[model samples]
Target: MINHGKELFSAIVPTEQKGLKRKIYVITKAFIKL
Candidate 1:
């Protein structure tokens, strides 16, 4: 059970990180355009 939980966590973290990075990129781009 612990190993399965760790696998799920590893999978989720990268996707969330990618989403956050994209959001930051978009915000930065908008700020630059302003």
Candidate 2:
């Protein structure tokens, strides 16, 4: 059970990171446009 939980946590982390990266990219693009 502990290993399964760890796997799930690890899986979630990358998705969150990707979302964060996308947000940063959008912000940067907006700034460039301005």
Candidate 3:
């Protein structure tokens, strides 16, 4: 159970990071347009 939880957590973390990076990229582009 602990191992399964760890795997699930690791998978979620990368997805969250990707979302965060995308958000930052969009914000940066908006700033550049200004």
Candidate 4:
């Protein structure tokens, strides 16, 4: 359903985006520190 897909996108996409951002941040920080 179109509504279902939109709901799924709203719920899931931002969370995954934020998680990946945090991971990249940590990795880059560790790299810089070392």
- Judged by TM-score relative to the true structure, which candidate is superior, 3 or 4? 3
lDDT of 2 by residue, 3-34 (tens): 75565556556657678776556556545655
Please state the error at residue 3 of candidate 3 in Å.
Answer: 0.2
Candidate 3 residues lying further than 4 Å off, grouped into runs, are 19-34
In order, candidate lDDTs are 0.60, 0.60, 0.60, 0.59
Ten residues in sequence with the least summed lDDT for candidate 3: 25-34
lDDT of 3: 0.60
lDDT of 1 by residue, 1-34 (tens): 6775565556556657678776556556545655
Error of 4 at 27 (Å): 0.3
Q: Tell me the number of clashing residue pairs for each predicted model.
A: 0, 0, 0, 0
Worst lDDT 10-window in candidate 4: 25-34
Error of 4 at 26 (Å): 0.3
Residue 21 C-alpha lDDT in model 4: 72
Instruction: Point out where model 1 deviates above 4 Å.
Output: 1-18
Off by over 4 Å in 2: 1-18
In candidate 4, which residue pairs get closer than 3 Å at backbone N, Cα or C atoms, i.e. clash?
none
As a whole number from 0 to 100, the lDDT of residue 32 in candidate 1 is: 65
How good is model 2 by TM-score?
Answer: 0.46
* RMSD of every prediction: 12.6, 12.7, 12.7, 12.4
